[model samples]
Target: MTVTATLAGLDPTTLGDALRVAGSPGFDRWQDQIRRTGGCSDPIHLTGTTVTRDRDTGQVLHSYSTEAEPGGRLRVACGNRRASRCPSCAWTYAGDTYHLIRAGLTGDPAKGTPHTVRNHPRVFATLTAPSFGPVHNRPGRGHRPCRCGIHHPADAPELGTALDPAAYDYAGAVLWNNHAGHLWRYVTIYLPRELAKCAGITQRELRERLRISYGKVAEYQKRGAIHFHAVIRLDGPDGPDTAPPAWATRDLLTNALRTAAARAEVALPAVGDQPARVLRWGTQLDVQAIGAFGHGEDLTEQAVASYVAKYATKAAEATGTVDRRIGELSELDKLPDLPDHTRRLIRACRDLDALYPDRKLWQWAHMLGFRGHFSTKSRRYSTTLGALRQVRADYRAAQQRAALGLPDPDDHPEATTLTLAHWAYAGHGHTPGESWLAATIARDIQHNRDTAREHRAALDTAGEW
Candidate 1:
């Protein structure tokens, strides 16, 4: 497992490229930049200069430039949330999502949420799409054979593919995905009314006495359909900080959610030869009460947070499709060994795009016609991703300032510091050798994190004993 031995096995061109980077005088500095970006697969290249000066005295305090850096450029993380695009950035995104969801459930004082939120009536609900047609699947309970008369393995490639492609309603499935976000919006709108009805009160009175807060993430099923998993909480009118009304209970919330989901529907007008359709949630609905501690069937705060975070970094790639946008129908043919079911789904998107210009099906063909944000939250759902990122940015900036021996901006308020900066995009992506090196660094970082997490878990278990 030596670096030299690993390099020896690489192709000649890659070996030569790696050796060139290793031999460069600025190699260490370049490595540091890569480390800072967490080994982003496709980093953005920038050329910039920044000068900070005292506002009162007009005295220059600090200055930075890429003039002396490797390649006269700075490398920054692309910050794409899709794991298929960039795993390092996606890992960071997932971590933020975990904290955001956790704060709303268990509460994080530092993130401005009080611990009282954990006592609030909360439920984890999964909303699924109505089936368009029969597909090959593993039957629940009994080990039944598929419609084609064969017991499929867990990893079978044809698991989600239609038993008969001609019989599958590809257009209906794609249309449902395109309007999934709208359906969720309708559910939110109908939720409070349902809740009020259960309490024998009007929707207006419910709004005055209580508020509904939620955090949700969309996950793609193997059938290329979009489903939602949400953490819904009943909060006071003002939000999580205040106590909910006496009438607010887990059972009531659960019942309201079930009713709201059933009532929320989207209507689509006829397109071409397609008939007018009404889209609604599937019969399979799961609503479970969240417990402070996972006891028996109850899902714990930690487990729910982890589950939602897991899918925040995923897209339609789980359905055996490409990650990037598909420009033309002709391009689908050029794709390497594209699955037949996936190809049809993509083709459906293209076909409908012309008739439904507003839906932008072609633009989201890669996503199987689903274009909504993967992760979303109500305004009162604890902290936000932007705020979490800002905290990290501020901390890193403070560290850099300390390293440069610059006075803290907070320390000298009498003389305010003015920062001026300008940056232009250069090129991006790594050389073949650099890609290998970056992958190695990413793996190392992940391994270290995994080891630390396992160690902490072991200590916790030992303490319990």
Candidate 2:
């Protein structure tokens, strides 16, 4: 039997509903709504009315109602950063992340960052979790057989699985993730102190002479441990626009990071009869100097930005864990589909939740106990995600204004406009037919973007515009 026929046979009700929607007279309008959402897999349905009034004249300039929209509701992308949930939204999020990181490195005047930031002493650093146990891994240097006597491929599923699962410290692993943020906080605190020691100055003196600005993103390793990829910059006390002191070189920053990572430790409170465990960064710290936009042998600003952005959309799923919450202990038994390692981690999280009620381990079990933001930046690092999103909103508003032939809001400062909007959540998700069509549209958009990028790259290589 054909796939469609088989699917229809397996779920007739859903198939029939999808078919009916496809044949409906409003299908084109429905497709338009879906396209406006960038083909989000689960677009949020909102029923609302919006009235735009000129405050000066007390006249209704414009009004909109979802009553005329498809299904009497407006749909918007869920805006989930997880690609697994919504690829369309995830793509948008990754693009925003890339720009945010790139702006900090190369600078964008529009984003309030100066081009002089490119000359700041910057390094791309990777901070990792201390090993809880030995896991199957491909030893660096040359491809060698694992301790398990197996020569694992690059994509091997067994790569991160413990050689002896029974002996693995699952509790330690989960707790490490829970405390990772705290550990990073300690590192940040100690970093300046280390820098001062290196410069033969006091912490107060270091602060007066130089400042540290950083942007970091957390990534889950195959072993389900959380690690950090960061762009660390040493700027003058005034921030990125000002030049760093002569003593603030890339080597000094790298050494300070190494010392801080080594010294930074967080000791957990002793629970029950268990002794307090001290958490610190793993021995495998990699600090690489970041080069200027188009020079030097080290990592380029664009490469570092792209690399950090790539991890911003990911979670524990990269390590075989599920991308959702575990509501109950019975849920563990039903998750036979999960890998043995992942299942054990979930079980450990659930089990530990009772012992450490304050930790709320079960709440973040899906994340393997991590609760930190995927991407974070210091205040002076660069523009914010909110600022980037505002830029997009402003552009869209401008387009709408031009299309409607409305006077520029900025041009009329004396007149104010009041917007009243009320929206109620209706529902989400699409009919199977809608899903199929939306997916096709998303693919086409991505393809066009990729093609345009390729063309641009080709033109650049050929030294043409």
Query: Global lDDT of each model?
Result: 0.91, 0.86
Tens digits of per-residue lDDT, candidate 2, 6-113, equal 334526666676677667777788877877788898899999998888887878888899998878989998999998889999889999999999998998988868
The TM-score values for the models, in the order shown, are 0.97, 0.94
- Candidate 2 local lDDT, residue 75: 92
Q: lDDT, candidate 1, residue 273?
A: 82
Residue 50's lDDT in candidate 1? 98
lDDT of 1 at 414: 65
lDDT of 1 by residue, 240-278 (tens): 889899889999999999999999999888878889999
